[model samples]
Target: MPLHPRPRALPTAFVAVLALLLAAGNGTWATTGAGAQDRAGSAPRPAALAGRVIVTVAGQQDAGRAAARAEVRARRVYRFALNGFAATLTEKQAARLANDPEVVGIFPDRTVSVAAQTLPKGVDRVDADRHPGAAIDGVDRGVDADIAILDTGIAPAHADLNVVGGKACVTGDATTRDIHTHGTHVAGSAAARDNGIGVVGVAPGARLYAVKVLSDSGGGTISDVVCGLDWVTANAATIDVANLSLAGGGPDGACGQPTTDPFHQAVCNTVAAGVPVVVAAGNTPGAGRDIASSNIVPATYAEAITVSAFTDFNGRPGGGGAAICAASGAVDDVFAPYSNFGADVDIAAPGTCTYSTLPNGGYGYKSGTSMAAGYVSGAVALYRAQNPGASPDAVRAWLLGTAQPQRSGFGFTGDKDAFAEPVLSLGDGSFPSPTPTTTATATASASATSTATAIRTATTNTATATRTPTATRTPTATARRTATKTPTRTPTRTPTRTPTRSLTATPTRTPTANTTATATATATATAFVSTPPPTATVVTATATATATATTGTTAAPYRVAASGRSANSNSSLYLYDRKPATVWISNPATTPPTVAFAYLDLGSAKPIGAVRWLVGADGTADSFRVQVSNDRATWINLTANPLANGPTGTWHELRITTTARYVRFYVTNPNADPRIGGFAEVEIWP
Candidate 1:
């Protein structure tokens, strides 16, 4: 079976427990291995290693040793090794040995994704600055505190991060250098130095220890995670905070017990050693289920301090207005649409569209509860620095006790209890005082130079609307590079007065052939596409009135109320005029590889029943959403996940029931074909 999208990865039990869980992390798209075998055949490519499995042996270290010997006797080849008496094996071999008396259990080694960055707003929102630093008194800023980031890894050379040292528990390497941007973003949010070039962190002075568990592909196995936990446990005396911006399966039960669940015990032991473990509550929406009952690990564990996510309405800390999701109320703080909430969530922080550092000294935006957890980890580091003698339980108590409770309710059910309690401020009167520095705006430019730790002299204007920055990739830990090669303009569609028809829709123009040379260099580094084709000119043709509408009858024509294209292009009005020949295209040059979206505002109120799209060029769109809204303020999702489209120029219609003045077509996930996204015609039925 293939793995479905979930927050972080799936859950895994110890050697005694047999079930294997495979869930994806925040904002990652995973595909099951269904391709052909390779030529050499010694080992399958990591991305397509479907037959690879991790087997756990019961008992103690002695039992693991016995299991290894038994596997050899059975003619099974074991690759990786873990402290929990586990080893990686072939699927067939694992099944054959599962019934062995010495073998505890066998399961698949599932992949997880990297799931970061308006991190300071979240920190300030939690009130972490009051206790110490230049603004207050004493030495706050996590001067002596250490946080162990268990993720893809940290860029050891990033000027913004004070990375003291780390280990690659999964790769068996000593250097914990990050190639993926996920871990770097988390590290920046938790502790990007006070250096002025990039964004600041809650504990800018904290020492970061990268415990690489997940691979650069953003996935890993229970064995790898177990290795990381064991390493942290051995060094718990020096590490004060452990940030787990990853997640997996729900717990079978509570965390107090160690017999049934090894994961629970692993995290529990770390906490018992006085190191506070902060985890993401997850981005999976609980829908109707009480989130408290959900089984997400680490977050659900009683010993771990779980953090949820909120949208800062104005996209700034303490700033208020409209939220990322229309369903969220108009306020400074509101629950993020993707955030998981319930009794398990101890605190909420800004997680939507947070801009932070990328792996190779670059910076961009990311969103998820994983991003929210980073803020809490920084706060924990600050608290630990201020009170070196405070126990984990005492620190957790003060952190939760001093939080500012939310007053506004979440959407639909108006559930306030699920996430009403959050950390709005953090500060204690225990530290010393000193110099004052002016706060700088947290923003990144298109071509930023990787500079040393220093404050920025120029300030960037804060953005309030939901905007995705260009895609970025960190090729190596020692160098810096931008994913986008050419300068691309922002796509725009502003609605005019008349409702009968919308203004012309514009598709991004093809970049010059020269642009391809620069783009080709980035393909190897970014995870957005595995094997990209050679430079091929992507052409989007104007759709003519050839195809007939299949879904809805013509209603008053609606123009684009608001639209955001990932790249700049010329405008074409034929998109909404019932024409089938004209098209709207997205620019593939957008950094951070973002999806395009449009909000159509009906000129007047009307009964909307269906929406149809004629997809061209690329036959499929990986993921998208159709949502309706009244007054362009509150919106409702009509479908979940992306709809599978047909071949080029085929019209796909979605039926819905809603009377609204606004409709939005948002591409939440990027298409497999990065160069082109085409829509020949859009039809709305009454």
Candidate 2:
């Protein structure tokens, strides 16, 4: 006989809102006596409530068994974010659980929906396009951070995204693949790669982890959402940031201690684990407009960064642009008409007509506070890349601190609540250099010694001449070839000859004792026409003298006074340190078509023959140029064209003949792999 499989557990009912309103206890209960009747009779029991309820336990215990002890079937158990479980329970069963001292509170499971309606220009609206590290253009350089999208699963096959991994918490869904198109759209807005394809995201190329909480219909219960949060908290070490573009209706109140709001408690726990959460201020349906505190969940939680929506048709700050959604009454540079607003909202971002990737390798527009939250999530990723270990509170502070305030020309005209929240802006795209840990030093020694030997032969044929004792001389035909090549070779010989002539003249000025020295000098000078060996020797001597004339200068080895990023005092001494493992890296440019530069300042001007560097662990540069500057103000390129196709973990050498006080390395188009451009070691040879 074949056995039948057990039925899958499901929620009994889906409520619209789950409010947290604790009631005073009536009396103690005794299971074996009339006291139990008195306790049950004291409170006016509402007609047996039956549905799926979320039970928040007081401590970290077995949540599933806790529900079982109350005679309910647990559908899901949450461990990391909240010590709780979701179970199907009747009124008496839920009441019995509430009486247990270990149980915190029990509330009905509510519905949650995706907050989206979307675009690429939202990236520009947040000024992420202006940041070099953002790489908003279709460049390969990706943000070096991971972002988790908690929504209806992402499209696993989306070509434009770097979907690393995911987890599915919704019922009957084994994979975190988007069938609803909402989570995929949200993922694209947060970090679609800048691969010159369909569209780019705010934080281009950040690793995306899909945490599927909602289902294909773009809806799910609070239990499903909490299940996703539990997964996020468990993997908090790998996730740098999280984006929640979904919302639910609920009473606004503080979580923990006196009150028990499971959703808010889960969000707080997630933030405390170091992963910053960015959430959307919900959208009101139809023509209804309400403050965010009225219906938005997680938005009311102070632990997360709540984002409001603003319309930007032109991707700029000024008003008067054409409205894309005239039906919704959206005006350019103003708060989106359908967005929820109130003191709970932390910031605003572009959410109108957001162009982004959709399911099945497609792309389209979505409009909602969900899109706004995505922009903020991308910005948070950029920050996390620069500050790897920043706390959630620190991330929030930096984001708000760098934002463009309404008073500073980013203000929108029509917020119903009149709250002047700062608008997001990725300022200048430059970040503070990482603190120095260890120092590495490089000592370059270069010496050129040229030795020349000249032999002149003469033959005379004697023929008797009566009066003058003169002999008819037959000249012997002699041919000689000599070539001398020094590591430091200048293309122009005119300047070299001038210095050679002056040095020769000085030796000839000496009196009788220096007569032979003058002849030898003349012979070396004459060799400039027939042979370059002697001339090269004289030029090398002259170069040595000029180098010695400067203070703190040495003959062959050159000493570097300092090294750092161009036009910045932040020390990049690791570049000069001989250690190949130590590196000085720059944050990937938020925007593309920009350069990241670092410079080495020699104690004084010296001849630089070649620059050798080892590619850092982050990755290799796509193209680079070597520049020389006599004064740090003006620079001349030593390499006419950028060196391309750099290999990883290998030392690359660019041979050039130039003399300067400072040498700079410019990564014009950095490799998109690691995004952060840097060199492990740099050696400048004389």
Best by TM-score: 2
Q: Each model's TM-score, in the order given? A: 0.49, 0.56
- In the order shown, what is each candidate's alpha-carbon RMSD? 24.3, 24.3
Clash count for each candidate, listed in order shown: 38, 25
Stretches of candidate 1 off by over 4 Å are 1-60, 72-83, 90-108, 116-119, 133-142, 171-175, 250-259, 285-294, 313-319, 322-331, 408-419, 428-686
What value does the lDDT take at residue 63 in candidate 2? 77
Query: lDDT per residue, candidate 1, 318-421, as tens digits?
Result: 44455434332224555666666666666667776666678867787777777777877777766566556345654554454345435422111233453344
Local accuracy by lDDT, each model: 0.49, 0.59
Q: How well is each residue in 74-157 modelled by candidate 2, as lDDT tens digits? A: 888888888988877876886677566566666667777676512366777777777666755566677777788888888888
lDDT, candidate 2, equals 0.59
Which residue runs of candidate 2 sit more than 4 Å off their true CA positions?
Answer: 1-49, 117-119, 285-295, 323-327, 429-686
